[model samples]
Target: MKTKISHADVLDITAPSGGTTSGLAVLIGSLFGIAVTTNVAGDTVAVHTSGVFDHVKEGAGSGQAWAVGDAVYWDNTAKRLTKTTTSNTKVGYATAAALTTDTVGRFRIVPFA
Candidate 1:
Protein backbone atom coordinates (compact mmCIF):
# COMPACT_ATOMS: atom_id res chain seq x y z
CA MET A 1 0.00 0.00 0.00
CA LYS A 2 1.26 3.44 -0.90
CA THR A 3 0.83 5.78 1.99
CA LYS A 4 2.51 8.65 0.28
CA ILE A 5 0.25 10.89 -1.71
CA SER A 6 1.54 14.07 -3.33
CA HIS A 7 4.69 16.06 -2.79
CA ALA A 8 2.55 18.75 -1.16
CA ASP A 9 4.71 21.48 -2.57
CA VAL A 10 1.63 22.90 -4.17
CA LEU A 11 -2.00 22.58 -3.13
CA ASP A 12 -5.44 23.59 -4.30
CA ILE A 13 -7.08 25.86 -1.75
CA THR A 14 -10.40 27.62 -1.78
CA ALA A 15 -10.10 31.32 -2.26
CA PRO A 16 -10.95 33.40 0.75
CA SER A 17 -13.35 36.34 1.05
CA GLY A 18 -11.44 38.69 -1.20
CA GLY A 19 -10.24 35.77 -3.30
CA THR A 20 -6.64 35.20 -4.28
CA THR A 21 -4.38 36.84 -6.82
CA SER A 22 -1.56 35.18 -8.69
CA GLY A 23 1.93 35.95 -7.39
CA LEU A 24 0.55 37.06 -4.05
CA ALA A 25 0.56 35.46 -0.64
CA VAL A 26 -2.72 34.32 0.86
CA LEU A 27 -3.34 33.24 4.41
CA ILE A 28 -6.21 30.94 5.27
CA GLY A 29 -6.18 30.62 9.03
CA SER A 30 -2.67 29.56 10.03
CA LEU A 31 -1.93 27.92 6.70
CA PHE A 32 -0.61 30.20 4.01
CA GLY A 33 0.69 29.80 0.51
CA ILE A 34 1.62 31.72 -2.57
CA ALA A 35 -1.16 31.87 -5.12
CA VAL A 36 -0.16 30.28 -8.37
CA THR A 37 -3.33 31.42 -10.09
CA THR A 38 -6.00 33.98 -9.48
CA ASN A 39 -9.49 32.84 -8.53
CA VAL A 40 -12.70 34.17 -7.04
CA ALA A 41 -13.84 33.42 -3.56
CA GLY A 42 -15.03 29.82 -2.96
CA ASP A 43 -13.11 28.73 -6.05
CA THR A 44 -10.14 26.44 -5.93
CA VAL A 45 -6.79 28.03 -6.65
CA ALA A 46 -3.32 26.59 -6.91
CA VAL A 47 -1.02 27.68 -4.11
CA HIS A 48 2.66 27.03 -3.73
CA THR A 49 3.22 25.65 -0.28
CA SER A 50 6.95 25.23 -0.39
CA GLY A 51 10.04 26.57 -2.11
CA VAL A 52 11.73 29.95 -2.37
CA PHE A 53 9.64 32.96 -3.26
CA ASP A 54 10.24 36.67 -3.69
CA HIS A 55 7.67 38.56 -1.71
CA VAL A 56 6.97 42.09 -0.65
CA LYS A 57 8.80 43.02 2.50
CA GLU A 58 7.98 45.56 5.17
CA GLY A 59 9.67 48.64 3.81
CA ALA A 60 9.12 51.82 5.73
CA GLY A 61 11.54 54.62 6.48
CA SER A 62 14.81 52.71 6.32
CA GLY A 63 12.90 49.48 5.81
CA GLN A 64 13.81 46.16 7.45
CA ALA A 65 17.09 44.48 6.77
CA TRP A 66 17.23 40.70 6.58
CA ALA A 67 20.38 38.63 6.61
CA VAL A 68 20.73 35.12 5.31
CA GLY A 69 18.84 32.61 7.47
CA ASP A 70 16.88 35.34 9.24
CA ALA A 71 13.41 34.28 10.22
CA VAL A 72 10.55 35.70 8.22
CA TYR A 73 6.89 35.88 9.02
CA TRP A 74 3.68 36.53 7.15
CA ASP A 75 1.76 39.63 8.08
CA ASN A 76 -1.79 38.77 7.11
CA THR A 77 -3.28 42.14 7.86
CA ALA A 78 -0.52 43.95 6.05
CA LYS A 79 -0.45 41.32 3.31
CA ARG A 80 3.32 41.26 3.18
CA LEU A 81 6.44 39.76 4.76
CA THR A 82 7.78 41.02 8.06
CA LYS A 83 10.28 40.26 10.77
CA THR A 84 7.79 40.82 13.56
CA THR A 85 6.99 37.50 15.18
CA THR A 86 4.15 38.75 17.28
CA SER A 87 0.75 38.25 15.70
CA ASN A 88 2.40 36.78 12.61
CA THR A 89 2.93 33.38 11.10
CA LYS A 90 6.34 31.83 10.62
CA VAL A 91 6.58 31.53 6.86
CA GLY A 92 10.25 30.91 6.14
CA TYR A 93 13.76 32.23 6.33
CA ALA A 94 15.71 34.71 4.34
CA THR A 95 17.74 33.11 1.59
CA ALA A 96 19.67 36.28 0.87
CA ALA A 97 20.58 39.54 2.47
CA ALA A 98 18.14 42.38 1.99
CA LEU A 99 18.85 46.06 2.23
CA THR A 100 16.97 48.20 4.72
CA THR A 101 15.46 50.09 1.78
CA ASP A 102 14.83 47.07 -0.40
CA THR A 103 11.24 46.61 -1.40
CA VAL A 104 11.43 42.87 -2.00
CA GLY A 105 13.09 39.99 -0.22
CA ARG A 106 13.82 36.43 -1.27
CA PHE A 107 12.79 33.71 1.18
CA ARG A 108 12.12 30.02 1.32
CA ILE A 109 8.62 28.87 2.32
CA VAL A 110 8.71 26.43 5.23
CA PRO A 111 5.56 24.41 4.62
CA PHE A 112 3.48 24.83 7.76
CA ALA A 113 0.08 23.27 8.03
Candidate 2:
Protein backbone atom coordinates (compact mmCIF):
# COMPACT_ATOMS: atom_id res chain seq x y z
CA MET A 1 0.00 0.00 0.00
CA LYS A 2 1.07 3.61 -0.60
CA THR A 3 1.92 5.25 2.67
CA LYS A 4 1.03 8.91 2.91
CA ILE A 5 4.28 10.82 2.89
CA SER A 6 4.18 12.75 6.13
CA HIS A 7 7.92 13.11 6.03
CA ALA A 8 10.77 11.68 4.04
CA ASP A 9 14.32 11.43 5.25
CA VAL A 10 15.59 12.74 1.98
CA LEU A 11 19.01 11.64 0.86
CA ASP A 12 20.52 13.19 -2.25
CA ILE A 13 20.97 10.60 -5.01
CA THR A 14 23.61 10.68 -7.71
CA ALA A 15 24.07 8.88 -11.02
CA PRO A 16 26.77 8.96 -13.69
CA SER A 17 25.60 8.96 -17.27
CA GLY A 18 28.30 9.92 -19.81
CA GLY A 19 30.67 10.59 -16.89
CA THR A 20 30.09 14.36 -16.50
CA THR A 21 28.96 14.37 -12.85
CA SER A 22 25.65 16.20 -12.23
CA GLY A 23 24.01 17.11 -8.93
CA LEU A 24 22.32 14.31 -7.00
CA ALA A 25 18.60 15.18 -7.03
CA VAL A 26 15.58 14.29 -4.84
CA LEU A 27 11.77 14.89 -4.88
CA ILE A 28 10.34 14.78 -1.38
CA GLY A 29 6.59 15.30 -0.91
CA SER A 30 5.54 18.71 0.26
CA LEU A 31 2.51 20.15 2.12
CA PHE A 32 0.33 19.74 -0.98
CA GLY A 33 -0.33 16.95 -3.48
CA ILE A 34 1.80 18.68 -6.08
CA ALA A 35 4.95 16.80 -7.14
CA VAL A 36 8.23 18.64 -7.50
CA THR A 37 8.39 18.20 -11.25
CA THR A 38 7.67 15.06 -13.14
CA ASN A 39 9.26 14.25 -16.53
CA VAL A 40 10.80 17.70 -16.83
CA ALA A 41 13.70 16.13 -18.60
CA GLY A 42 11.44 13.80 -20.55
CA ASP A 43 8.78 11.12 -19.96
CA THR A 44 11.00 8.61 -18.22
CA VAL A 45 10.24 7.71 -14.61
CA ALA A 46 13.93 8.35 -13.89
CA VAL A 47 14.69 5.55 -11.42
CA HIS A 48 12.75 2.33 -11.37
CA THR A 49 14.42 -1.03 -10.62
CA SER A 50 18.08 -1.71 -9.81
CA GLY A 51 21.50 -2.11 -11.34
CA VAL A 52 25.17 -1.11 -11.02
CA PHE A 53 24.56 2.55 -11.75
CA ASP A 54 26.14 5.93 -10.97
CA HIS A 55 24.96 9.24 -9.56
CA VAL A 56 25.64 12.91 -9.99
CA LYS A 57 25.69 13.73 -6.28
CA GLU A 58 26.94 10.74 -4.28
CA GLY A 59 30.43 9.47 -4.82
CA ALA A 60 31.84 6.10 -5.96
CA GLY A 61 29.24 3.94 -4.21
CA SER A 62 26.37 5.54 -6.16
CA GLY A 63 24.64 2.48 -7.58
CA GLN A 64 27.17 -0.11 -6.50
CA ALA A 65 24.94 -1.73 -3.87
CA TRP A 66 21.80 -1.66 -5.98
CA ALA A 67 19.39 -4.23 -4.52
CA VAL A 68 16.12 -5.47 -5.99
CA GLY A 69 13.23 -2.97 -6.06
CA ASP A 70 15.69 -0.10 -6.18
CA ALA A 71 15.06 2.99 -8.32
CA VAL A 72 17.59 3.53 -11.07
CA TYR A 73 17.83 6.62 -13.30
CA TRP A 74 20.57 6.61 -15.91
CA ASP A 75 19.29 9.48 -18.03
CA ASN A 76 17.46 12.56 -16.87
CA THR A 77 16.33 13.77 -20.29
CA ALA A 78 14.76 10.44 -21.09
CA LYS A 79 12.88 9.97 -17.80
CA ARG A 80 12.83 6.20 -18.28
CA LEU A 81 13.03 3.32 -15.80
CA THR A 82 16.61 2.14 -15.99
CA LYS A 83 16.36 -0.63 -13.42
CA THR A 84 14.24 -2.09 -10.61
CA THR A 85 13.94 -5.26 -8.58
CA THR A 86 11.63 -7.37 -6.36
CA SER A 87 12.04 -5.01 -3.42
CA ASN A 88 10.14 -2.28 -5.17
CA THR A 89 7.69 -0.42 -3.00
CA LYS A 90 4.41 1.00 -4.30
CA VAL A 91 4.73 4.58 -3.22
CA GLY A 92 1.66 6.78 -2.91
CA TYR A 93 2.91 9.31 -5.44
CA ALA A 94 6.47 9.95 -6.53
CA THR A 95 7.74 13.53 -6.77
CA ALA A 96 10.68 15.64 -7.98
CA ALA A 97 12.07 19.12 -7.38
CA ALA A 98 11.58 21.97 -9.88
CA LEU A 99 15.12 21.90 -11.13
CA THR A 100 16.80 24.92 -9.58
CA THR A 101 19.18 24.65 -12.44
CA ASP A 102 18.68 22.87 -15.72
CA THR A 103 21.96 21.24 -14.87
CA VAL A 104 20.38 20.02 -11.63
CA GLY A 105 17.85 18.01 -13.65
CA ARG A 106 15.10 16.40 -11.57
CA PHE A 107 14.73 14.27 -8.46
CA ARG A 108 14.38 10.71 -9.78
CA ILE A 109 14.41 7.77 -7.40
CA VAL A 110 12.91 4.27 -6.99
CA PRO A 111 12.98 2.57 -3.61
CA PHE A 112 15.38 -0.35 -3.44
CA ALA A 113 15.41 -2.95 -0.72
Best-performing candidate as measured by TM-score: 1
Can you give the TM-score per candidate against the true fold? 0.94, 0.18
lDDT of 1: 0.91
Error of 1 at 113 (Å): 5.5
Instruction: Assess candidate 2 and give its TM-score to the true structure.
Output: 0.18
lDDT of 2 by residue, 2-85 (tens): 977533433222323322212233232211111222433323223322222223322232343333343434333432223332
The C-alpha stretches of model 1 lying farther than 4 A from their native spots are none
Highest lDDT: give the candidate number: 1
- Model 2 residue runs over 4 Å out of place are 1-67, 84-113
Residues 14-37 of candidate 1 have per-residue lDDT tens digits of 899999999999998878889998
Q: Root-mean-square deviation of each candidate, in angstroms?
A: 1.3, 14.8
Cα lDDT for residue 102, candidate 1: 88
lDDT of 2 at 107: 30
Backbone clash pairs for candidate 1 read: none
